[model samples]
Target: MTIQIKICGLSTPETIAASADAGASHIGFNFYPPSPRSVAPELASELAAITPRSLLKVGVFVNPDDTLLNEAVRHGALDAIQLHGKETPARVQEVKASFGLPVWKVLSVETDEDIAAADAYSSVADLILFDTKTPKGALPGGMGMGFDWSLLDAFDKSIPWGLAGGLNSENVADAIRATGAPLVDTSSGVESAPGVKDVDRIAAFCKAALDHD
Candidate 1:
């Protein structure tokens, strides 16, 4: 099966180019200001301008208001919206309706209950992204943490979903084989430092994910 790959938290032009050149199906830009990966809407637009239309340009937000969403969509040239916050199903549907764009809801997971929680978004979100749950007071994601992959063994596949958190070049193949995830996302895993993406790792990660049988 072909596994879709998303290289998220990209802020630099070189790394963005590397991600596209490496065959990433989606490119993500952070809109949350507190995160080191965050970029202004104008800069996001310039970075997105280099992306091929065939590839998805995702704007990652954390419980964003309509104003932020509007600016990001307009200036960032986003093709999809990734809600990586505590947005409810109603909010997801609202964003989809308001922006007329595909919405991806991120569900942080640690156990079976968290995995089961995804059912609530099946009808609301265009896609569901299962990421590792963060510790209290920590950032939402991109901390290089991973939950037990086995927790997803009995997950419902009615909704289109993707796996995130702690994925990298060395382990993405195993991750894909383990959960049979159709899509895989990465951020810190391809970074040289906090918010500093490494081009070689980006290429390697894409290679590993695509080369997996």
Candidate 2:
């Protein structure tokens, strides 16, 4: 099976080009100001401009209002919007309706109940991304913390879904095997430090996810 790969939290032109050159299907631009990987819409637009047309540009936001969303979409020319905060299904629908772009809803998974909650967004969200839940005061994702992969064994797969959290070149193949994830996402796992992406790691990660059966 061909697995799609998303390299998240990309800010610079070099890393964005690296992700696209390494065969990534999507590239994520973080808009959450508190996160280490955050970037303004103008910078994201510059980075997005160099991205190849084959790859989708995804804007990552957390509890964003219409103004931010409008600015990001208009400036960044995003192909999709990824909600990584406390947005409900209604909000997901509203974002989709307003932007006319595919919406990806991130679910912070720690238990079977978290996986089950995806049902609520099956109809509204274009895709459901399962990521690990961080600490109370920590960033929403890209902390390189993974949840129990077995928790997804019994997932109903009501809609298109992807796997995220703690994925690196060393463990992504195993993760794909464990959950049969159609798509795999990573940010910190491919970074040398918080928000610093490594080109070699980016290439290795995409290779690993693509080579997996």
Best by lDDT: 2
Cα-based lDDT for every prediction: 0.93, 0.94
lDDT digits (tens) for residues 38-152 of candidate 2? 9999998788778889889999999999999999999889999999999999999999999999999999999999999999999999999999999899899999999999999
lDDT of 2 at 80: 97
Candidate 2, pairs of clashing residues: none
Q: How many steric clashes does model 2 contain? A: 0
Which regions of candidate 2 are displaced past 4 Å?
none
Tens digits of per-residue lDDT for model 1, 60-149: 999999999999999888999999999999999999999999999999999899998888899999999999999999999999999999
TM-score of 2: 0.98
Q: How close is candidate 1 to the true structure, as a TM-score?
A: 0.98
